[model samples]
Target: MASKRPQSPPISLVELRKRCRDASLSEQELTDYFLPDEENSKPFAPALKLNEALVDVGRARPGPDAISKLYADATRAQTPLPKKPRVLTQTFRRAAKTKLLAEGDSWFNLPDYIYPKTAIDFLGSDNDFDVSNIALWGDELEAMVRAKQYRQPLRSGLFGHFLFSGGGNDVLGSIPAYVKPRKSGDTDPAHAADYVKATFPQKISQMMGFYRSLANDARDATAGRVVLYVHGYANAIPKKGGHYLGGPFETLGFDPVAHAPLCRAIVAQMVKLFNDALQSFAQSTAHVVYNDLRPAMTERDWYRDEIHPNESGARKIARIFAESVRANTPGV
Candidate 1:
């Protein structure tokens, strides 16, 4: 519904006046200025905050008080573990349509919906992973490969190829359907498993498939080892890190209790999905990865809003993510 990306805080009127006076306005000129800001600006404010938290978290060493402090802080007021209400989650439109998701629908359980608009006037790319490819879809994810089919606006074809055999996709955008509870009246205890079996396996499927497929076309690939990345909140943790990142990250922008807990809950379900995927392979040797953004968000300083980290904070998240992917990629 809302945008995961924050609209750019308005540009300083002084700067605008200066530009207009010198004809420099051309550089900053645009219709519905908010569009450009949303499309191009990086939410570095939170990244910077996380950078500071890295230092705070780094202080905890081998000691009882340190451990106590760490735990105490997690439950405190400023933690980013549970984000505040109604923050928007980002989603790419091309991918949503390609995935054949219904209008006004979402892949996750909550309602801050993921909807990516085409953004005609915007420059650069919607996704960071694939610059060459202008648009993307959930079926294009590299990690969780599986069968696909579409019709008309979506696709009217037979069961097609696996996911992400095509090329790089924004790790955050590639996620398709997450594992949601089967509802109170679910007919079967194995509903999640049966659903995975009967339907086309989603991203989680691609990641947990028997083998890793790094081909050039998604619709023509087989099973593969995927690098699955589950997203947190608007603080949308980065998958890389920077030096002296103040917090455990480079961002400080989420209400952790609202956002972090959801992320953890989502990830926990992901673990279960991985288990189901393992069973599907029969010979099971696929790998999966998960990263949490709560701890750092809890111990950071630039946590101005008790949510998303600052720019430096985001850097910390990215750094940690990069390392985790490197370390645990070979095994589930």
Candidate 2:
């Protein structure tokens, strides 16, 4: 007989430890065992969250040696910026270029999708930006702000460019909660704005507050040297096949196929609200720059599912960020 597959929760602590030590265990298997799918849970479980099973197994955190090994690749082979013009002061002649750091949702964290690619990965390859990314899959904007995983990396003014990709997961996750029901006599909304509930603006406002606070923290931590690069998602046409949100839509009586127009309208509204808030916030905040990704990705760029861009789409988005880097920073 074959050994039974390990289950998620409800498994014995002994089993959890055994699996953790098992070199053959794949990342997905470990993730599922540690962070099981819960009903109505957020699309992606917090990848970095501590689990009790591991705690009981005596592995509280990555040991220092492990941590060092993990980040070695990212820290190595960084290209230093060229010296400033001779006209500049001798003290500031050859200050190192600001390091790049990234934090946020799956857009920055998803590396194991069908094609082993992500926007951040593309940015590194296409733009030669050496970024130490701490983004986690399924992380919402509020969660990312509260997590503060970037704090340690942002210190010492080492990281000058803080690339962020958030708000998309937050808005997508909240769609079922705030989307208004289609009225009996309603026609397909002419504008995307018409599809959302009256409270959606307030919801967006609250999310903006999270973004603002996060930006402030990043800036303050680096003593205003770090320039934040915030990006918003493209207007993706809604469809039936995503990891999350599909069931909620059907439950609300909106079929992605039959109600394509309405679904797209809602997605548009969400995207607009998120992007507008980010752009406005960047305009007001010092050292904060917004990269509008709406034009970079089209339906063709996305995977078969409603959310997530394919490899080509990821490359296109990375090109936009490369432009932003060139415009803002020098000697890359």
Please name the candidate that would achieve the greatest TM-score relative to the true structure: 2
Question: Which lDDT tens digits does candidate 2 get at residues 1-332?
Answer: 99987654544445544544443445544444343223323543322222455335353454323322222222221223333324547676455333578887777765242233678877766435566677755667887788887776787456778888877756766667777666554547575466577787888798889888988899779888888899878777666744455556666677777777777778877888888988999899898989988788877898654567788888888888878876888653
- Runs in model 2 deviating more than 4 A are 1-41, 44-98, 111-116, 185-187, 241-245
Q: List where candidate 1 sits over 4 angstroms from the true fold.
A: 1-27, 30-203, 208-211, 215-264, 271-313, 321-332
Alpha-carbon lDDT, every model: 0.28, 0.65
Give one digit per residue, the lDDT tens place, for model 1 in 1-332: 97674432344434433433443322123221211112221222111111121123244232332322222232221111111223334653223211101111011100001112211101112232111111222223322233322112122231111111121122222223323332343433233343232233465555533133322122232223223233232223222232111122223322223344433333334334444444344333233233444344433422333223444554555454444433643321
Q: Give the root-mean-square deviation of each candidate in angstroms.
A: 20.8, 7.8
Best by lDDT: 2
TM-score of 1: 0.25
